[model samples]
Target: MAKTFASTGDTAEKTITFAEIGEGLYAFTAEGDPNTGVIVGDDSVMVIDAQATPVMARKVIERVRTVTDKPIRYVVLSHYHAVRVLGASAYGADEILASEATRSLIVERGKEDWESELGRFPRLFQAAESVPGLTWPTMTFPTRMTVWLGKRRVDLIHLGRGHTAGDTVAWVPDSRVMFSGDLVEYHSACYCGDAHFADWPKTLDTLAAYNPRALVPGRGDALDSPKMVADGIALTRDFLTTLYDSVSESAARGLTLKQAFDRSREVMDPKFSKFAIYEHCQPFNVARAYDEARGLDHPRIWTAERDREMWEALQG
Candidate 1:
């Protein structure tokens, strides 16, 4: 292969920032890395999207400690990605919540995803051995679940499929603030390896209807205004659509997977080359896009072996 598989060479640590976006809502962002959301209610706190590992989650805990001593009573898993859900134990919350589909995905592919992601992006899994095992949600809901942190209310809703089949958002209706887990990204490449390219845009529409005043994205800096929120949603939509459109066009011409990958990159690189994870995501994104364009609706599970085979086929 001409290059390493996925983000193997991306070892530089990002600068973490904790910014207050609402009354007591904060976005814990690390440059373009996955972000964590904090909502402080009257007497307790709720965390959204735990980091890749317990050691990594400790950093977010440190920041949360600076602002409030209220126990983190809830930990919400936005989806079933290992990098996002494996750190639930760090919170030691009363209960961990996730969508029913998310929980099922964990049962089906969680272990495989753990191995695949760790091999691809080692930097994100700091102290990976500290992870006791696959994180499980003690509580599961179907479409929407509401939790009251004293007077404050948080609604965890599954708008539709996007980044994954079980994508869910933490919505604060009263404050018009949302924690969109990988459903929206600002100036960062959308990782579509496990994504539904066709369903993602429609789901974004569901999120936009809320007219969010502030949003904590899965990656990049927080969106603190309605305009920024809209832009983030638009950017994510554009990335997914652009990628799918390009691959669809190539596939329609009966291009092979490698040929389709090259053609799609030519079209996408000019616009997205500089985005975070652009290089790491390109090969997998195109491979999945190629499958979807050819009428494969469900994305294939990606194990470590499949990851290597796909990388070599496209990047070699």
Candidate 2:
């Protein structure tokens, strides 16, 4: 469908970089691919988001070993997306954590999402068979939960909905560093396939109030300074607002889905065409924005079958 969903051709290997943004805090970024945040405490370590497969996660583990030999006690699922959580088993952490909404999403659509994402982006899942099965969170929380690794404290908060209903961020009060899931993206297209477009900005505001000295985004380079952190948040906000405004206006003018897509593309391409996953995400983002602008508060679940249906309808 739509030629492997737009990004299957992107098989070029990305250069991986692991930067220590704060004391014992690292951001493992592979160009524009999904990023993994590492928080090492005095005695133990914590990982923010797992990669797509256990094989892929080993790369992060290899990097982790380079710095500290502390045992990884926790793996935090930023959200319920298969691309982010499926590699959890590789960590062998004592506990896996996620929001209650995330857990419910896993129960509801985890398998379908696994097939859907694996098909859409083959490059991310290096070894598909290596994924044992759907990753499940052993521990779940509602709004906010705090965990301590010796003296270091990590606060996991479900700020609000943005990338998905279960969006959660890890806040390290001591370092003022935030591990924002897909709630924010920097110089990359926000995959709005399951996004709450209207509610995203408000959540961004809540994130900004923290005034994080550094931010580890779900994708793109990690922001090491306060100004870069603010810039990242601003860029994410602009992308969402522009996408919704373009599609909402077209919808108001009685445009069909295709017509709305065309209008949205004309407005977004010039500014965001170079962003990571812009091509892969535009159609889905426009479709969701169109739906949300029409008063749909909750995003519709996306399955492998539905993904093909939407892609063929818009891209065919």
Candidate 3:
């Protein structure tokens, strides 16, 4: 292969930052790694987007202990991705929650995704053996569900699909804070291996309608103000549109997937090359864009074998 496969070369540990974006709401971010959200209520706590491994999740739990003694009663999944859901067991929460669509995706591709991501990002899965099989949600809702942590109201809503087919956001109406899984990234590359390019922007629109005062994105630093939130959303939209448009144009011209990848680089590199995981995400992003442009409604499952095959075909 011409380049390292995915993030296998990235082995250095990142500085973990647990920032309070709202009143009693925290965002556990590790540079450009996947982020986790904490919502502390009058009674119990709710955690959003568990990390990739049980050991990694303990890092979040450690931070959660510093603030309040409230037990983490619920763990909410933003999507069905292995990197986001496999750490659920570490929380030991009373209930694990997810959108119905997310649960369905897990049932269909959970095992494959776990294997594929472990191969792609070895550093994220610090203790692979510790992941006790696929993480399943004990509770699920179709579109929206509300949970109360004492007086705090958390609305888990499926705005639409962007990062994946089953993306959900946890909204705190009292504080106007939202925990957006991978739907809105800040100065970080959006991983679109299972993305719906055409449907992503509309989902962003629905998320924007809420006008969150503070937002904890799926990756990068947390947005602590409305301006930052707006910028984050716009940046994500721009990234998606630029990628899809370039790939769609290439497809329209009957270009091969490799050719389309080169075309996409020419357009995206100048604008987003400096972003976190930009290179790691580009091949998969372009492949999905190409598939979507050519009328594939659902994303193809990515197994460990398929991951290497696609990487070699494109990145080689």
- Listed in order, each prediction's TM-score against the native is 0.99, 0.98, 0.99
Higher-lDDT candidate among 2 and 3?
Answer: 3
Query: Mind giving the per-residue lDDT tens digits that candidate 3 earns over 14-59?
Result: 9999999888999999999999999999999999999999999999
Q: Estimate the lDDT of model 1.
A: 0.94
lDDT of 1 by residue, 32-71 (tens): 9999999999989999999999999999999999999999
Candidate 1 steric clashes? 0
lDDT by candidate, in order shown? 0.94, 0.92, 0.95
lDDT of 3 at 197: 88
After superposition, the stretches of candidate 2 with alpha carbons farther than 4 Å from their true spots are 1-4
Clashing residue pairs in candidate 1 (N, C-alpha, C atoms within 3 angstroms): none
Candidate 2: worst-modelled 10 consecutive residues by lDDT: 1-10
**Could you tell me how far off, in angstroms, the CA of residue 88 lies in candidate 2 after the best superposition?**
0.4
Ranking by TM-score: 3, 1, 2
What RMSD value applies to candidate 1?
0.8
